[model samples]
Target: MSYGKKEFRKRLLILTVLISLSFLVLLGRLWVLEIIQGEKYLFLARNNSIRLLPSRAPRGIIYDRKGEILARSRPSFSITIYPWNLSQEDLAETVKEISPIIGVKEERIYQTIEESQSPFNNIPLKEDVDLKTATKILERKLSLAGVDLQVQPRRYYPDEELLAPVLGYLGEIDKDQLQALRGRGYRLGDRVGRDGVERVYDEYLKGEDGGWQIRVNNRGQRVGTMGHKEPLPGNDLVLTIDRQLQQVAWDSLKGRPGAIVVLDPNNGEILSLVSAPAYDPNLFAGSLSQEKWLSLKGDPLHPLTNRAIQGEYPPGSAFKVITTIAALERGIASRDKSFFCSGTFPFKDRVFKCWKEEGCGTLNLKEAIIHSCNVYFYQLGLETGVDNIVDFSKEFGLGKASGIDLVEEKKGLLPHRRWRKESLSRKWFDGDTINLSIGQGYLLVTPLQMANLIGAIANGGRLYRPYLVKRIISPEGETIRETRPRLIKEVILKKKNLDLLRESLFGVVNEKGPSGRRTGTGWRAKIEGIEVAGKTGTAENPLGEDHAWFIGFAPYREPKIALAILVEHGGMGGKAAAPIAKRIFEAYFNSKVGEKKSRKVEE
Candidate 1:
């Protein structure tokens, strides 16, 4: 019994020592954490309760030259997930719970989470959510952990389709863009400009994004902001476009499958540019559905195409202006030299017939221009030769991109001896020259190039590099940059020849032909009080009706505005395209009168 009691005492002593040592160790750990390392752990605990939420800065406001708002950002709600705060199973449950409320599929949400490079970063689950849906998410905040509601900026175009082609639309940054721009602070799912000026000036328009350190309760509800960095709004853009004139030009198209470009002849400032079959840019403000995207992609009219710069079509009779320039400058045809048009001109094996089968008899250079005599030009083209024709054409900015500050600018086909040899492995023929002289046979020009061409003629042969943006203003209203008139080249036409050409173009609009029974080809473009000088063109398309073209400058002598109008498959330039020019001219002159009257009243 004594031995057993001794053994039990020994065991009890061992238990007491072990227990005492454990208590001592616990006391030392508590002291260290409460005193020496207290601030560090406290900061860590506070950080666990604090969440960093991104505050999207609104993109710059786009304004017309008249101070009219074209595009701006509006506040919208978005839901995001903090991956670090949730495990895989937790995320699945949270996604499933919020899927029906946000109208996003569980699979998509999971895929988004999976694509995230870091668990510490926030993943966007749904963007641009409605107020009703956002309220639902907030109401279920207690049940939905790691999900956050944020207010972000959504791009909006008040004019919608009226300026879609120029203003463009925004879309999420793709893999390639993200990879290229990641170092520049661009992240996945960032809204980037997909086309138009948006793409061109994205660097200026996009602002610095800011964020807030928000404190949340156990239920994932916001308590207070620990700290925040205020978002800096993007710079503002002032375009050279005149909203009133832009509206007039757009209205003139009237849903036709064509384009219209209006510019200041003295400068390269684009006043109004319109492409028909426009789509609403507002459709892209939110997450575009597959159905909507497919519909836009599948449309036959291709509403997304900016016809002003992208659509390449034969200039039709517009090429006559270039041919006339080549003829007079190269000494191939004199102003008084008359050519007899016998309704058709036979070249080698092929015969080319004029539009007027009866014929334009004994027409001089000026007379032929007014009449748009195809036979007269056919003879002139052969004499001037294709080389000189191509040279003069390039000098006038044809067969190449205009270097306009827009994307997708196509360099129109400028066929020559080398191009013929290399592209078709064929020799140049007289038939080809006859066709080229009349703006037919593989000759293509964009509407922008035509506008630039006419602007050069109006401004006395000085070709200016066409520009759209007039000024870029900072958010604080300071001018960051301003655009000046940039002269590309001068055609250096003879004063006498230029004067006669101008007069002939004036006659094309204002004067009747030698045959009083018929007016000039551009007669329909005549305004009551304004003297307009322009030429008309009919591009023959074997596939369909001929494309109509009319390029002109208004106020004849002291030209202010120049226009290039194209009506695809619209039979005649005078009938289809010239009338549109008349309306646009009337609108511009009327607006100018109204502005003067308003200024007088102010004075």
Candidate 2:
């Protein structure tokens, strides 16, 4: 009887200990569920019942110096899908139902969903969808689980083709770009600047994005709005471009394949920048079609290229100004020194023929420039030597970028003896010097560089860095950033030399022949009231016809506008390029006159 009582008490003690331990285990699990792991589970539960949709902030508006709208954003609808909210079977069915309505293939929608970074994140299946299609998608929202009709801001370019190259275009962020920009809050399907001013100021132009959390039912339909955050619009950009002047420059091109750049000689502000054969930037506002993209990429004219900053061509006789400066500065030649051209210059084993086969008789520096005489420059090049010419050219910002605000500015080739030896493994010959003297045979320059070079001369040798943007304004109308005129360098040249060159250029447009008719090659560029000084060039091309060129500054006494014009395969500079310059000058002066009269009337 004593042993049985002892055994029963031991059993009761063991059972009591087991029950207490079970209570402790339950309490530990309750602490973990309500404390340590509670927030994570709560978030998961909320996420499953509620959808968080991101709202893209409207991009900054782009305006010209005159406050004319260039680019803005408009409300547009897009079809988006959340992969995590729906089961695999439901997601496939949703894509099938909406793909046909939105005119997108079901396979493409499935691929986009599969390639999305996270199931919780919304992937844009089709952007910039029309109202009719969006309405249809919403009407069947009950059946299409996890599919959302989202209103997004779409980029709009008002100036269209007139400012295509300058304004650039927007494109969706791809996988490669996402890796670099993900930390910056850039998500997949986000539109970013692809080129031009848009690209240069992307950070300032992109606004802060917001998000919305809304309650949803078990059927994947939004039931009630829970929370919302308004998006902040981006800052505004005011460019130095004048829309009127830009139009004039574009009109001057007239479907030609070339570029024209105009600058404010006083401040280095880009007044007009036009690259011909331009396309409408609005074509890229939405999802660009593969066929349209291929057409643009494959077009022979390459209308998309910003030729003003990228096209490198031989400056031809327009480069004679540099040669003349080098010759005079090096004391190899004087303004009064005369060269006799008997139609052709005889050198070792070959004869370099002048453009005028009949030969221009004895001519001095000033007269040679006015007549565009090749033989005169040929002799000057030979006397100046290649090294001296290269040195002088570098001082004028040649063989390097002009440091403009735009990207992809090509540093044109300025070949010297060392470069020839290193690049071609050949000895520099006297013939090479002669070719270099006339602005041919490996010497190349972009239209922007040539314009800046001429602008320096027009502004008394002060080279200013070319700029496009004038100021950036915030949404509160506060100036965030303003660009000031930046002086790049002052070209070292005697006042007398610059004056003499300036006078000779004036005669190039104003001088008349013995018959009282204009004889200068660039006489066609002469404005009636404005004293214009200019140079003309006919660049030789092995592939096709000669490229025509003209570089000039208007109102000779107080130069304001400086221009560089190029016409690819457009024949002589005087006949083709100079006329375009003349039209631009006329339009500019006439507009100034009109403005002055209007101001007087207001007074």
**Top candidate when judged by TM-score against the true structure:** 2
True-structure RMSD, every candidate: 6.1, 5.4
Best by lDDT: 2
Candidate 2 off by > 4 Å: 1-44, 174-183
Residue pairs with colliding backbones in model 1 are: 317-537
Model 2, residue 219: displacement in angstroms?
A: 2.7
- In candidate 1, position 284 carries an lDDT of 90
Runs in model 1 with CA error above 4 Å?
A: 1-47, 87-93, 115-118, 217-220, 513-518
| TM-score between candidate 2 and the true structure | 0.91
Positional deviation of 86 in candidate 2, in angstroms? Answer: 2.2
Consecutive 10-residue window with the lowest summed lDDT within model 1: 83-92
